[model samples]
Structures are given as structure tokens and as C-alpha cells.
Target: MKRGEAILVPLGAMIAGLLVFGLFCAALGLNPLAVYASIYKAGFGSWYSWQNTLVRASPLLLCGLCTAIPARAGMIVIGNEGAVVAGGLGAATVGLATLSLPPVLSLTIMALSAMVCGGIWIAFGAALQHYRGVSAVISGLLLNYLAVALMNQLIEGPLRDPSSFNSPASYPLTPDHRLAYFAGTHIHHGLIFGAVACVLAWFLIDRTTFGFAMKIAGGNVRAARLAGLPVGRLVVIAGFLGGACAGLAGMIEVAAVHGRANESLNAGYGYSGILVAFLARQNPLVIVLVSLLTGGLLASGGVLQREHDLPDATIAVLQGILFLFILLSDTLYGRLPFFRSRTPEPKPHAIAA
Candidate 1:
């Protein structure tokens, strides 16, 4: 695909999605224009709204990486939810255990533990794909359910804090250990972490020899093997990097937003990230922009419900529609006349000759 098509196709699909959503809303007797205006105002019109969008985007950036990275290695791993859950569990376990240690050392340990746990979680799926010829997609989907079940068991049993009553949760981190916000804003340092991760990931995937190898492998595994590229190793490494990003996202939720690991850690950021990755065509830098847009859409959910008497799942429906449109638009690649290369016809002088 041409660079211009890369940008324009997704943008055009998004606009189509909005138009379809508007029709859906109009069918329900809601003014589509008012609904759109409300979404804009609630998501990006004010400083407060921007903060909310950024907060939501932070985790999405990392989660989107979970899918984006492995895609370069020709793996369709969708276990980001599993990786996030595992990371959260790892972070909470370490955080509770190191309560007596210095804040810096403890936080570092927690972060490392989260990354390791998450990497292992997703890497397992890649290992299955490489060794057993199992489908990464199936393994990843199953792993997501398994991770959620494991987390529920641990949080409700062994890791449950005695003080927690209504909701099951692990011990909370101390104020000093929790992630601090930007000077005067609700936005936490996790946003910076996410942004940095995206940049580093982009560099790794777009500007490195390793990335080129992965691209070659992804394009043709048989050719990659003939060329002596370690396709298995590349697959595992990509899975690990992707899962590590997701794990860090889980850690951020514990340290910055939730203050502990619980059901809240299972919020659909992982799934939403799959959408973000697809929308951005798995480009890390593009993922950042897509995350922000998705975050804005999510941030407006509450306002949509409150102002229009729409259900809480209204945003979800819109997301589903958008995803469908994006998938459909994929068929247009190389098929669109504007994006296709023009072939010059042979001159008539040949006939005269």
C-alpha cells in the first residue's frame, strides 16, 4: 500500500463508520448532529476532557503494542488481555511483598516482575505456534480466558486483602509508591511511559536490521527459513516484546489508576487495543495517534449515556461498527484506482514503423 493510502483509507473508513453510526442514532429519534457534538465536547473540547482522553490512551498505547509487535513476525497473537492480567498479578504480588523496601527499588522490582510475567504469558502462545504448529490465534484466545480465571481465583482467595469487603482486591500500594500525576493534572507518568514505548517500538520495527528480518519472515516464512533467518526466535522475541508492553500497561493500571490489582485490571483495554492496532495497521507510531482517538471515543461514553439517555454500551456499538468498516476497507488495498500505479500505453508510432 502507498503511504498516502495508508493514511487516507483508514480515515475514509472512520468517516464511513461515523456516518453509519449517525444513521443508527437517527433511527432511534436522536439528532445525529447533536450526538456528534456531544461526543466532541465530552472527549476533546476542554482541558479536563483532554486529560481524561490521555489517561485512557495511556494503557491503550501499551496494549496496542501487544498486538502490533507480534504482527511484524507474522503472528496474529491476541492474548493481550491475558498478558495484562498476568502482569497485574505479578505486579500486585511483588508490590505487596516489597512493602518494607525503598520505593524506588520496590517499584523497579514490581515493574520487572510484571514484564517477565506478561512476556512469558504471551510467549507461551508463540512457543505453541512454533513447536506444535498450533494456531496462535486459538492459543491466544484460550489464554485470555485462562488468565482471567487465574486472576479471579488468586484475587478472591490467596491475594485478597482482608480489609476488602464488597469487592475483592489485593493490598493497595502506599501513596509514595503509587504513580504520581503530572504537576497539576490528573494525567499520570504512565502516559509518558506509553509514549516513550511507542517511539522505541517504532525505532525497533522501522529502523533496525532485526525489524527487516522480521518483516522478511512475516512476508514469507519459507523464504525466511531458506535465507537462514531464525524465524522461531523472531516469533518468540516479537511475542515477548509485545507482551512486555502489555504487562507494563497492567502495572501502570495498578500503580497509577487502580492502586491495586483486581477485576478492574480486566477492563477491556486489551480488547480495545486490538482495535487500535488494526486501525493503525500495526505501526507503533500510528498506534499512538489511534490510541488517542480511541481514548477520546471512550472518554465520551459517560457523557453520551447521560445526555442522550443512551445505554452505557453505546460506545461499544460504535466501536464494533468502526471495526467492521475497517475490516471491510481492507479489501480496497491495491484495488482502488487512485492508489494503483498507472501503466503507460505503447505509442502508435510502432504501427507506422
Candidate 2:
């Protein structure tokens, strides 16, 4: 596909989505223009709003990678929510155990634990797909339910903090162990972590030989196997990397935002990340920009509810519409004459003769 089409097609789809959403809002007796204005005001009108958007974008960036990485290997894993839960559980367990240790060491150990747990969670699905012939998508979906069940059981039973009665959360991290915010800003260091992760992911996928192999495998599994590529290993590794990113996001949520593993850990960020990844076409670098856009949409939900009397699910509806439009746009690729390459025709042989 041409670069212009790669960018323009999605942009056009998003514009169409917005128009449909506007009509939907109009049908509900609201001014579409005012609703859009409110969204912009609440999401990016001020530094405070920008901070809110960035804070939310932090997790979206990581979670989006959960799908984006495996996508390069032609894996359709959608278990980011499960991996996130597992990561949160792992981080909480390690963080609570290492309270006596230095904060830096404790946090580092917690992060590693989270990554391991998350990587295993998703890699298991990949393994099933490769060896057991199970669909990665189905396995991932089932695993999401399993992870949530496990988290609920642990938080409500063995790992429950005595002080967290109403919420049933895991033990909280100490203040020193929690992630610190950027200087003079409400945003946490997680934003930096997310941005750095995106950049590194981009380099890993776009610049590395391993990434090249994965792309070849994704493009044609049979040809890749014929060429002696380790397709199974690539699939598992991609799943692990994707899951590891999500797991880190889970840890960030616990250590920076919630300070504990709780129900709040499943804040729909995982699902939202899928949308961001799709919208960005699974490009790690573009994920950063798409995550910011998604984060803004999420941050504006409260404002929409308060000012326009819209339901909280309004953003979700918009997302659904946008996703549909994006899927439709996929069919137009290579078919549009504007994006097709022009081939020069040979002059008549008779003229040369």
C-alpha cells in the first residue's frame, strides 16, 4: 500500500465515524456540535485536562502493544485484559513480599514478576495455537475470563488486605514504593515508561532482523516455513512481548494510580487498547498518537455525562462505530485507483521496427 493511502484511509474512516456519531447524538436530542465542543474542552482545553488524558494514555500505550506486537506475527490474541490482571496480581504479590527491601529493588522485582506472569499468560495461548491447534483468539478470550476469575478469588480470599473491606483489594504498596509523578505535574512516570516502550517496540519491530522474520512469517506462513524460519518460536515470542507490555501497564496501574490490585485494575483500558491498536494499524509508533486520541475520548466521558446528560457508554458507542468504519475501510486498500501505482506502457514495437 502507498504511504499516502496508509495514512489517509484511516483518517477518512475516522471522519466518517465522527459523522455517524454526530447523527446518533442528534437523534438523542443533543446538539452534535456542542457535544464535540464539550469533548474537546474536557479532554484538551487546559493543562489539567491534558494531564488527565496523558495519565490515561499511559496504560493505553502499553496495552495497545499487547495486540500490536503479536499482530506482526499474524496472531489475533485478544487477551490483554487477562494478561493485565495476571500482571497486577504478580506485581502485588511481589510488592507485598519485598516491603522490607529497598524501594528500587522491590519495584524492579515487582516489574519483572509482572512481566513474567503476563508473558506466560499470553504465551500459553500462543503455544496452544501452535501445538494444540486451538485458535489464539478463542484461547485468549477464554483466558481473559479465567484471569479475571483468578484475580477475584485471590483478592477476595488469600491476598485480601484486612483494611480493604468494601473494595476487596490486595495490600497496598508503601508510599516510597509507589511511582513518583513528573516534577510539578499530576502525570506519573508511567507516561515516560509508556512512551519509551512504544519507541523501543517500534525499533524492535521495524529495525531488527527478528522483526523482519516475523513480518515474513505473518505475510506468508507456508513460505516462511519453506525458507527455514522458526515460525512457532516467533509466534510465541511475539505473544510474550505483547503480553509483557500489558503486564507492565498493569503494574503501573497498581503502583502509580490505584496503589493496590483491585477491581479497578480492569478499567476497560485493555479493550480500549485493542481499538487503539486497530486504529493505528498495529504500528508501535502510531500507537502513541492513537493512544492519546483514545485517552482523550475516555477522559471526556465524565464531562459528557455531566454537561450533556449522556450516558457513560456514549464513548463506547462512538468507539464501536469507529471500529466498524475502520473495518470497512480495510476493503478499500489496493482497490482505490488513487493509491495504485502507475505503470508506464511500452511504446508500440512497430514504431521501433
**Model 2 error, position 100 (Å):** 0.9
Off by over 4 Å in 2: 344-353
Residue 101: error of model 1 in Å? 1.5
Off by over 4 Å in 1: 343-353
Tens digit per residue, CA lDDT, model 2, 160-210: 999987889988899999989999998999898799999999998999999
Candidate 1's residue-wise lDDT over 1-353, tens digit each? 68889889999999999999999999999999999998999889999999999999999999999999999999887899999999989998999899899988888888899999999999999989988999988999899999999998998899898899998998789988887899989999999889999999999999999999999889999999999999999999999999999999999999889999999889888989999999999999999999999999999999998999999789888999999999999998888888777776578899889
TM-score of predicted structure 2: 0.96
Clash number for every model? 0, 0
State the displacement of the C-alpha of residue 59, model 2, in Å, after optimal TM-score superposition.
0.7
All candidates' lDDT scores?
0.92, 0.92
lDDT of 1 at 155: 88
